[model samples]
Target: MPGKTKRSGDLATALAALAGLSYLPPVAAAPLTFASPPAEIAKAVLDDEPGTVAVGIWRNQQGRFALQRNPVGSVGEVVEDDSAHAQPLFEIGSISKVFTGLLLAQAVERGDLSLDDTLGKLLEAKATLKPETAAITLRQLVTHSACLPREPQDFPGYGTPNPFSRHDRWKIYAGLSGMTLEHAPPCGAAYSNLGMGLVGQLLSDHYAKPWDVLVRENITGPLGMRDTMQYLGRQASRLATGYQHEALQGPWDFDALSGAGALRSTAPDLLLLARALMAGRAGPLGPAAERALTPLGYFRGDEIGYAILIRGPAGHRTYHHDGLTGGYRTLLAFAPDTQEAVAILASNSHASPVKVLTGITASRYPIAPATQMAPAPAALAEYGGVYQADKDTSFTFVAQDGKLYRRSTGTGFRALSPGGPDTFVDADAGARYVFSREAGEIVRVDYYLGDSGFGGFSSFSGVAGLRTKEAAPPVAVVSLDTQLDYAGHYRARRIIRTDLDLDVRAENGQLGVRAGNWFRRPVFPVAGKPDRFAYENGRSQLQFERDAAGHVAGVVLYENGVIRLRRLP
Candidate 1:
């Protein structure tokens, strides 16, 4: 009853705040200035999206400037009214990883932990861990090189919109007990939530305190970030409603993985955090912040520093992190050389605040324009192949007409002009693809699409099986009747308080499936396997099982984990 009451209270508070905002004056744009023009940046970001709310802050030697704009509309509401300021609470998502990284630095500074300390050394007394995981070091976790999967394999309630709501400590430890590394530590940089969460958990165990408490005592409190916290707790009244597209969405909840993306803060608080990072001084944790910004290696189109990503060249480097949860999107970035920092927080998940944030940063410190280059035909041919980020997502590079082009499902081929050696740029989408070579052989490609959703880039390794045109096979179409047989509603085997359902539909003589809001796509029958379906360009597969009567009984969905769902009726 207490939990229910809290949920109701939170909703009431959020709705009440939204209602009160209706009567408030329209948020005015700050006056323009040459150093950091708020009006110009706001026009570029908010002009297209009329009802979006944005809070922007810039700090430099000239001074600090802040702006807030709440367009006239509530998410999913017909009425055109909403309000926000620089101090309202918002979920910072993965930016919380930076705070966790800072905690690791602090621990090392205090002689309580070492960057090279093994997972076995820290958690051996708490629970048994696999040798591979035990061998992973704290540095690897912070740098995202531990080769841990993005999420726990046995993560419960995987199909739910709030995937991490039910992922508590018990589930985390249980998931780790059966865990095995896909690759050894330092196996290139892969963004991982599990690795960062473990860092937070280790810190909690060492201090014998909760993650939030440790953060507040060591980081937020010292930085004067009074409005920042892990849980809204009694401050729910200040929390803003989150929106995905035009629909209202639930806020993310965290348990063991709170360290990954659980912290919530206001724009002012984040600006304070950014200032501390740029100034590289805030007392006890100041030195740790400096250490956290030190570059470890290159990853995802940027230098993989501790928990932060560093971009641009020397003297114009930008240290930053961006985050996305169920319904919130946030970005915090700063150029230390110019002492200019920007924090953009939005309630709308689809908002592209990063563009405006980067625009402002560029105004202060311009990035070099991308130039075109021409590589030898042999060099271009060697990079031609299919690269996959997951089962359902892949990019195929084709050499045609003496030029390199990229093609993918549902999209036409686009020219990939050379930007540099082993690097290509997509002029249309403003994306850059950099190839990684080992012994002069292409091994992986990193795609940088700019800071918009979650992280700005994804690393896709070249698929050896699809290296040649002849190696790939064609897909077979399923019979109409057979496709219809698989159409039904199914329920996830492991359900929490929230009911999880999967919908398998046959449309236009094709079979498609969706689980909650994760993704929806047509599943084609594999070349020779009639019962097996490939989705996301063969990045994932689904298998249908039959009953004694030869009727469809259940479905097995395979991606990062295997999920079994039974027919509802």
Candidate 2:
């Protein structure tokens, strides 16, 4: 009788608490003079958003200025009041890849490794890498051209709410042993955490030490980045608690993949590194650091010269990297030509620090805006369709009022103005979209962000990947008895280090799924498909599997890849 109308009391209470509570306002803090360009930018960011604790550092030929506000919160406590020099530890995330990239350059200078060295030569004995993987060079890995998936196949099955917590060295090697290249080496740039993780692992093995040791002895140590490290260790008290939508989130830990996004640092330390890079000082790794800043080639339509992203032409360019973890967001960017740099570290996961960094950079270096024009109605209609890059990522173009709008699950819709035939520009964000046609039919789309559309852009091809807006038939009402039968506990088929269990329950005549204690959401039955259910706000689907006796035995999750979960007795 409770099947169709009952709700979980705990879930209801949690949701209520989440909705009722408001984020704490920024505490009264330091007064920053808006005299300098960086100071003005910092004030604008703080004034625009309340309850945001941010630290920004600007260094130019004139001098250095740092700005801060409020106190950094961790878990539920405010650890330290923010100051221009407050050394509150913040997770650097993917920026760790930039450090690893510098390490590779250092290795090359020491004659310890070469960018041309093959993966087979470095990791042959540790894991049974695919033949194609063996042929991938270190340069390809650092530039994200090794064609590796963003994460390993079993990454989801790891089960921990914090995915990287238990993905240790052995598991990493195991994943590599079974990996099959989806595309050949030097396949147009696809950002890959796996590839960067491999760079750290190979460097550690070659040095006969741990990755943390290698980073400290070479990159951070030489640059005088005392607070930067893979682990907080004794400095845990200085670490800020990360927050997501006002909910407390745990800090991320790394095993083998620590090289991907494992370092915690302070704004001052990042500024120190940036200053050294801009000065091109002669230190132990200084020459190598300069080399790492060189542009390797075009990636996703941007320059990929080393481990970090490079933008603009040769003489005028910005070399930078951005990082995101559960509760932290960071931006480290600098322009070499103007001797200016911006480093922003924030405690809120949803915060967009890059926008602030961009503001600072744009003020220093002006970018020409793209000219906009009204496109014909037929042109707008031709590009209107749903295009998907992967199972979990997609874009939809719609024609409304003679203008083409682009939509995604993450960001809603933004109207695009035509810059040229089959080319559109988003003036506010400085993004450009160019459509490719074959025999007068729209076949592909390319998207470029920043740089006023001077570099390469990521391409999405194939007409078969398009989705239509046509309405579907009404879903048949599933029997209450059948819905009850689907209730059970399920676990991933692959044995993982952490728990990956799915609990299904029939509540209020609908099916609800909870993965461990992290994700709990309702699922709806698909029209004309009795065994399929949609979840994750329709970004993912689950297909129930049956045993020989016609009883539910398991489920297949369809997202970026297929994951099998067996029904547990």
RMSD of 1: 12.0
In model 2, what lDDT does residue 8 have? 27
Q: What is candidate 2's local distance difference test score?
A: 0.64
Expressed as tens digits, the lDDT of each residue in 65-177 for candidate 1 is: 33444443522212111122335688888889989988888788778899999988887766688888788899998888888876677554322456667777767777777
Expressed as tens digits, the lDDT of each residue in 1-569 for candidate 2 is 00111222222222221111100111112222212345444454333222334454454344344344433342221223224455578887888888888888888877888899998888877888888878899999998888887677676522234667677878888887888887779876667777898889888889899999998988788777898998777899888777543445678888888788899998778877777777663634567867888877665434776788875556777777877666666778877677666676766554555555344333433334546567677756778876654443455676766767664433335566777777776545445666778788877666555434343222321112244453222331255688777889889745565556787876434466766543245566676776898862576898999988999999888867888889988
Candidate 2 stretches with Cα past 4 Å from truth are 1-52, 62-84, 156-159, 281-284, 357-373, 387-394, 437-439, 450-569
512 Cα displacement, candidate 2 (Å): 23
All-Cα superposition RMSD per candidate: 12.0, 12.4
Instruction: Estimate the TM-score for candidate 1.
Output: 0.65
Displacement of residue 326 (Cα, Å) in model 2 is: 1.5
Candidate 1, superposed: residue stretches over 4 Å from native: 1-36, 39-52, 62-86, 157-161, 281-284, 356-394, 398-569
